[model samples]
Target: MTTITTRTIEYPADALTMIGHLALPADTGRRPAVLIGPEGMGLSDVERRRAEALAELGYVTLAFDLHGGRYLSDPEEMLARCLPLLADPDRMRGIGNAALDVLRAEPRADLDRIAAIGYGTGGAIALELGRDGADLRAIGTVNAVTTGRPGDAARIRCPVWAGVGSEDPIMPPAQREAFTAEMQAAGVDWRLTVYGGALHAFHHPPVDHTVPSGVGYHPQHAQRAWRDIVDLLTECLPVTK
Candidate 1:
């Protein structure tokens, strides 16, 4: 069984306070740690499950909440809150940095093998961390949006894997292609995989409800993405034992 604990870490006055959950293997030791950023809808039950799953794979995982403590299922409300934050890229980087600091301080975490993963807004946050040279071992993002800055790609020092849906309205095929081109031009080691006939939030399995908009859930894609994340972490942050 995995041992999980939830806690809140207060940031400086100008930064947001984060509510996060940490999970570790029941047999505990110094293990690789992953900082997980939540999706646009915030840290819902589905995201928590993902962290627990990573714990099962022998990682000490911390799923950080970007929204503080608020969440909304309505599309308009979700966009209203998430878009402004996304627009201010620096704020996202600050949040990621704060989470990274907290995770690095954990005695049971292998600081040298830290990695990050995120979805939607969270994905963008994870990407910004890597772009800012955060010393991450690896990064994986699902259906993330880029800020379209040119020089940001050159700062990444770790392997990056991005998963996107071909039909994702938020990140269209052209945008994804352009992002990939920029990454390649920067000489960053990166890989991108696009799933056909899928939409945004394809990795959120428990989010199936009639929101203010017409969005639904895709359980199959979500499961597959979760498995991919596990594999990526294992490959990038392998156990030393």
Candidate 2:
């Protein structure tokens, strides 16, 4: 097994003290880093584990918090908080920028080699960061491709990769088409992968709570989606060995 280390880091955003999980490889040199965003439920063990796995790949990684480090397990509560936040790009940017600041402050992070990848609401935040003209090497989102304000996507300077379950009602065919049209009109290099036989949050492991309709887990596609995301990092943000 690869040698890696982890720590809990905290920062401020939106009147809340955000908690972040940082993971690092054992190497002494600076390395590329990935900012991971979790679903609307907020940062959970799944995202933290993703940070560790990314660290194993030799990239410093940070799984950032939403909702001031609160993980909302109730569907109504999660939606109540996330829906408004998702609708506000400025708020999303604030949250993402806060996490970016925390990540950039880490000695192990390579400021020029940063990627943002997120799931669900987290993915929307990542997209907002890119749309706000952040210097991102790549943006990978799973199940969070939503329509943005007019001409906003033009600000994205990096490639965008999105994955979604084919049956995702929250991001159905019309939504996907609109997102693609925006990307195309913006002339951004973008890719969309639709996983068949899956639903929203297909990448997630089985959860113990009820999270509204149109959400499920598909282990096979989840692994495939992760591979696709890793490919995005490898192609756009490779670290020096």
Number of the top lDDT candidate:
2
> What would the per-residue lDDT of candidate 2 be over residues 202-237, giving only the tens digit for each residue?
999998888789999999999999999999999999
Q: Show where candidate 2 strays beyond 4 Å.
A: none
Worst 10 residues of 1 by lDDT: 5-14
Q: Provide TM-scores for the models.
A: 0.91, 0.98
Q: Write the per-residue lDDT of candidate 1 for residues 144-186, one digit (tens) a residue.
A: 8474467888988888888888778788978898888878888
Would you list the clashing residue pairs of candidate 1? none
Candidate 2 root-mean-square deviation in Å: 0.9
